[model samples]
Target chain A: MKIGYLGPKGTFSEEAVIKYTQGVENCEVVEFNTIPEVINCISNSLCEEAVIPIENSIEGSVNIAVDMLINDANGIMIKGEVIIPISHCLISDAPVEFKDVHCILSHQQAIAQCREYISKKFPNAEIKATDSTAQAVLGVKSKPGVVAIGPERAAVIYGMRIIDRDIQDVKENYTRFLVLSQKDGVVTGKDKTSIVFSVPNVPGSLYNALGVLANKKINMTKIESRPSRKKLGEYVFWVDIEGHREDEIVKSVLEELKGRTDFLKVLGSYPKFK
Target chain B: MKIGYLGPKGTFSEEAVIKYTQGVENCEVVEFNTIPEVINCISNSLCEEAVIPIENSIEGSVNIAVDMLINDANGIMIKGEVIIPISHCLISDAPVEFKDVHCILSHQQAIAQCREYISKKFPNAEIKATDSTAQAVLGVKSKPGVVAIGPERAAVIYGMRIIDRDIQDVKENYTRFLVLSQKDGVVTGKDKTSIVFSVPNVPGSLYNALGVLANKKINMTKIESRPSRKKLGEYVFWVDIEGHREDEIVKSVLEELKGRTDFLKVLGSYPKFK
Candidate 1:
């Protein structure tokens, strides 16, 4: 099996793929520069599956991934999910002291996660944003007085030293990555079905659509609103409910939602990550 | 009156401040580097009011601004809102052709917005991410073969020329900005109230909470979920209802919501921008 992930081999997405397919043998992992590319690869059959971060504990939704999964990758389905605890390390090529470092580099999200620590410790350092934390690690490999905040795996992958460990402001940071494949998972006793739907732009329309789930006593785990990408003030709701799509109640709720909503798409039914 | 906005002078936030306070004399506009800083300036009385981008047509919500308004800046209230049409321009110091540009710089959001345009026009250019589009304009001022994607105002402010105009991929891109003041706005008859609340982590908790508003026939304009920042799977919902908080129906809805949620914070009631 071939698994594609957003990577330069040291991203949290790569780490997620590793942990998710830990026991699987003969797995070939490929790296893509962006989330959309990973999804594109999945759709193009360049890879059998793709792993992408769906949500962060601090940052609500990974909009690019969610939007792509909803709009671009039509046939791909989420098969599983992995939760990885995020721990950012300040890495450098040389034995540089904290005060001597003149520049810091990382992805925008990583920089945001470590905002407070960076501002306090390296107020004078020039912050450079990169495409990915792993890319930052690669960029800073031969540069002195420059550090990259990335996963510890990045430091190892790029042959750099960790100048500081666990520098993120929030200690409880965790990212949820979804495993996407051409096939959706079969009904697991404990499963979650993810769907995206848009209600007509009328008063009480969203409430009426959500009532379909509430009326059937179905429990929704998450609900998020994203721009429908068609126009301003237009939105589509992404929801996760605690049941397989094959379940009778879940099927009925989806059928009722289909009738009520302007548009509805079932992304997938996957085993719940405990 | 002093108005604060996210700035290096050329951000959409600055434009929002200008449009939102149009025709007002003796208004001093101050610029802050980050959204939180702008909010802090308002809370600390450094500025009488602050304008920050709340949402985008393409991007769902400005999480930093929303999070700060919900968690950090107490006693601050939203006073008004302004909608700005975002038109990104490819700017440069010299009159260079698109083919001559070797590097492109912009804020990540701007880069994402103009992804198709940039990739199609300058496929080989190195993409650099900056803190803000204005900052990108500043960074490219002395560099040849480098261009920044920013508001057209930035080109005038920085003495740069627009190499390409309206380079954003989406023609309908618009950003919604909110004005924050120490004092809340009075009922404007046609008003909107924004509130942030966290429902208990139980099945049907959110459904029941929304039931309070639906039962009263109150129309909600927007609903967004942000991480509570305490732990994973915990979120606080931001809802914009179509009425002033002082309205009888709105008041009853809040009272009922307060009883059903674990945490509730009314951001403010303000005149809804049409």
Candidate 2:
């Protein structure tokens, strides 16, 4: 399998790509700059599969990944999912006491993930933003008085020593990554389907639309709304329902929903990843 | 008004706090470690108000901000929102060419946001994550061959020159900050209400609950689902509807919903920020 993911290396995205392809031999890892790029690569047939972090247990949803699927309704399905546990580390090249470090560098999400520890230990150090924790480690390695907060694996890859480990504010910080492909690789009859839709800017519209799913006794796993850029008083909704598109009930629900909204698209239908 | 937010200074959270509290005189900015801490500070009378980023245009949503409101439902209400445009810059201590830099640092979101730009311009540099962009700037400020991607303000504050500016991959990147207060801040009469609820695990339960709101002609601005921890199969939902709790229609909708769901709580009823 040729797998593409968001990475230069040592990123959570890279780790997820590895985990998802663990059973496959002769796997080719193609790194991209963003989730969308990976999706595009898969959509364009550049790679057989792509991995994107859909949501972090702590950070919620990654809209870009969802939006990419919504915008491109060309048969891409989520073949699998991987829940990767997150562990942030404080890394630096200097061996001086941690108190001597005057700045903490990391990605904003990492900062948020490790907020509690940083606040208690380095209350006064200037907090700096960087593109990634791996990059921050490089900055620290090249500097004399800086510390970087990232994953332990990132520290190892960047040749930096871990000054502190497991520093995330929450112990259960895990990211859910989706493995997408242009074609469905395998099917478990009991699968899930994702769809995006927009209804009229009037009351009762969404209720009427959701009625289709309710009437058919289908289970909805998730639903969220984002502002529609086309008009000010409009919104686009993303929904995850627990049934395959090929199912009789799901087909009926989609048929009924077609009449209730101005636009609707089934993002994908694939077997649920355990 | 005295203000509190999540910050150590120079974080996007601090930027959001400053943006949302625009033009308010004698506003003291207090920094806290967590979203709950910010709300607690406001609730305990340590700060008159608090501002936190509730969502991003690119990132979809801020889950912590949402969870904080559910837990601290009685004490705080979202008063207003700030849509701040985000721009990334590569800051370095020495005016070295972009190719001369061996590593780049930024917040994880920053890395995600500027994915394309970094891959195209400095594809070989190891990207590191940091706590915040400001910290990344500080790292690059002492390192001659490293670059940090952050807001332009950080470059100015840390005396690092910009090797490149406006490097974000997305042109429409924006973070939505919410202004929250213990009181409703004189309800504008026209307001929206937010609520969290848990329904029975049976199929069509959410649809039935939403049907009441639809039947009452109430429009939902947003809806999202998160796992409710107490039960294995149960789920909790967060919803935003276009009406005040005092409104007759919304009141009736809540009455109908209460009859169906096992648990429900009104998060707030503040005038919607335009």
Candidate 3:
């Protein structure tokens, strides 16, 4: 199997790909610069599968990923899911004292996850957002008195010294990634169905549509609304429910939802991330 | 009156301030570097009020603005809303044609909004993300063959030439900004009350809580779920309804919601944007 992931090689997404493919026979991984590229590789026949980050506990949904799936489903579907525990580290090119640090560099999301730590530990440090955390560690070689926040893997790969470990604001931070392929997985009995639905922006339209799930006593794991891109206040919702599309109850629920909602698309069914 | 805005001047937030404060006398508008700074100014008493962009038709909610408002209310309330039509322009330091542009610069959100245009016009141009759209325009001076996407106001203020006008992919783009102060606006016949509520991640918790609005026949203008920062799937939802908090139906709905939700915070009611 071949897998594509967002990378400079040392990102958490790379770690996700590694963790998900552990012990799998004959697995090869490719690194792409952006989530869209990582996802598009599957559709473009450049790769058979891809892993992309969908949501982070602290930062919330990765809007670009969700937006792409919502705006254009285009034969892509979720085959599985992975939950990676996020542990951000403070790394520098050389051993340095905390007070000596003058600039903090990392991807914007990594920087956001460590805001409180940054403000308290290095009150005077200037922040520079880089394209990726791995790039930050790599760039710090030429930039003195600069530290990067990212996975410890980046520090190891770049020959940088670890200044601090587990420095994220929320120690329990996690990111949920989706494994995308041309087709979804078969019913495993324990599965999740992700769907995108649209309703009018009127008062109870959403409430009415969600009733299809609530009435059947189906459990909804996640629900998020994105702009329909047509107008302000108009939205298309991405929802995850606790059942496979092949299940009888899930099938009828989707059928009922089609009538209640203006539009509905089933992204896929996948096993729960354990 | 003194007001704070996210600026180096020449941002859409600055334009929103100008438009909202039009016809007012003796208004001193100050520019801050970030959204947090703009919001913090109100609590620090550095400014009487601040104008900040809340949502855009293309980019959806400005997450930083929404997250700050959600995490900490701190006596700040929505005073009013202004809907500014967005029209991104291709700007250059010196007169340059489309083919001469070697790099594209702008804030991530602006770049995202104009992605289609950028990819089509400058397919090979390297993209650089700046702190703000205004900063992108300012930085273009020393960098040869670089262009920026931002409001025309930035081009005018920075003495840059407009290479192309209304270059955004979507022609009907708009951004909704909020006017924030210590207190919310007085009841207007056409008003919007923003409130946030939390429910357990378990099935039907959200469905039951939203029942309060549906039962009262209150029109909900917007609804979005943000991660609770505690766990994946757990969420706190921000909702906007069609009536002022002072209205009897709205008040009753809010009271019922408090009993039904794990946590509820009324973010205050304000006049709806025209």
Candidate 4:
């Protein structure tokens, strides 16, 4: 099996793929620079599977990933999922004190996750956003007065020293990563189905559509609205419900929802990460 | 009067403030590096008002701004809004051909907006993400082989040349920014009220909460779900509905909604951006 994930390496996405595969023999892992590229690789058959972060406890949905999975990647399905506990560390090139750091670099999401710490500790340090946390660590490796906030594994991979550990504002932060493939997973009793739909422009359109789930007594785990990309104020809602699509109740609810929505697309069914 | 916005000067946020203020005399416009800082300035009374992007046609919600407006900035309200049409340009230090560009620097959102253009024009160019589009333009000003994707104004502000114009994938892209103040706006007759709420963990909880709006014939302009920051499966829904909070119809709907929801917060009411 071949897997693709967002990386320069040492990223949570890479860690997710590794954790999902669990050191499977003969499994080859490839790295892409962006979330779309990872999905694109799977769409183009460059890789058989891909792992991408879909949501964070603190940051909510990864819009780029969700957007691409819905609009760009054709015939892609969520085969599995992994929830990785996230711990951000401040890593630098040397054993440097906090006062000596003049700049901090990381991905925007990582920077946001650690905002409270950065604001209080390095009030004057310049915050530079990079493409990925791993890229930030790579950039700090040759700079003495700069530090990067990323996974602790990044410091080991880049030969940098960990100046501080668990720097995220909320200590209970975790990212949910979805394993994508060309086909949907087979019926697993413990599974979750993800779907995207847009209701008609009517007063009770959303209420009617969601009523299908409420009527069937289906438990909705997540619901997010993203711009349909056509115009302002237009949105497509992504919903995660508890149960496999193969279940009779789930099938009937989706059937009713399809009729009420302007458009609907089932992204996939996958085993819920525990 | 004073206004704060996310800035290094040539960013869309700065443009938003300029467009919103529109030549108000003696108004001091201050710049903050991040969205939280911009909101923090308003919370700390460093600026009497602030402007921050709330949504994009392509990227959906600006999560940081939404999060702060909901959780951090106490007693702040949306006084007004500005809609800015976004068009990205390729900027470089010197007049350079597309083939000569080895690296492309931009904010992640800008890069994503122009993905189709960059991939077709500079297939092999390395893409670097920066904190802001203005910062990317600044980074490219001293580097000959690098280019940036940002507002056309950034090129002129940073003494750079525009290599290409209107490089965005979608020409219809626009960003909606909110003008925040300590007090909510008075009834403008044509207004929108934004609120965030969490329904109880039950099957029909969301349906019942949204029922408050549908029952009263209130039109919801937008609905987004963000992680409550408390748990993975939990979420807080942000809803934008027509009418000011002071309106009798809206007041009743909110009162009914408050009773149905576990927690609710009214961010503010403001005139609809024309």
Candidate 4 has an lDDT of: 0.87
Model-by-model lDDT, in order? Answer: 0.86, 0.74, 0.87, 0.87
| Tens digits of per-residue lDDT for model 2, A1-274 | 6889876678887888778777889999998765567888876898998888776655456656766676675678777777788888888886758678788887666776676688789876766655555666666876766898877877788788888778876676777777888765344787888789998777778878888888777888766665463332356888888877777788888888999999998777876666
Segments in model 2 whose C-alpha atoms lie over 4 Å from true places: A8-11, A73-75, A91-97, A101-109, A124-164, A229-234, B1-41, B50-64, B79-179, B185-188, B200-202, B224-236, B259-263
- Identify the candidate with maximal TM-score: 1
How much native contact recovery, as a fraction, does model 3 achieve? Answer: 0.68
* TM-score (C-alpha, index-matched) for candidate 1: 0.96
Regions more than 4 Å wrong, model 3: A95-105, A116-131, A145-147, B96-104, B118-129
lDDT of 4 by residue, A1-274 (tens): 8999989889988889889988578899999977778988888999998999889998888777888887854788888899999999999997888889998889778887887898899987777666689988998977988999999998899788998899898899999999999987888799999999999987878988988998888998889998988898899999999899999989998988989998899998988887
Of candidate 3 chain A, the 10-residue stretch with the lowest lDDT total is: A123-132
Q: Per-candidate TM vs. native?
A: 0.96, 0.74, 0.94, 0.92
Order the candidate numbers by DockQ, best to worst.
1, 3, 4, 2
Candidate DockQ values, in order, are: 0.63, 0.29, 0.60, 0.57
Model 1 lDDT per residue over A234-264, tens place: 8888899999999998999999898999989
RMSD (CA, angstroms), candidate 2: 5.4
- The 10-residue segment of model 2 chain B with minimum total lDDT is B226-235
Taking the tens digit of each residue's C-alpha lDDT, what string does model 1 give over B2-51?
99988889887888888987899999999887667888887899999899
Cα-lDDT of candidate 3: 0.87
Q: Interface Cα RMSD per model, in Å?
A: 1.8, 4.7, 2.0, 2.0
Compute the lDDT of residue A190 as modeled in candidate 4.
94
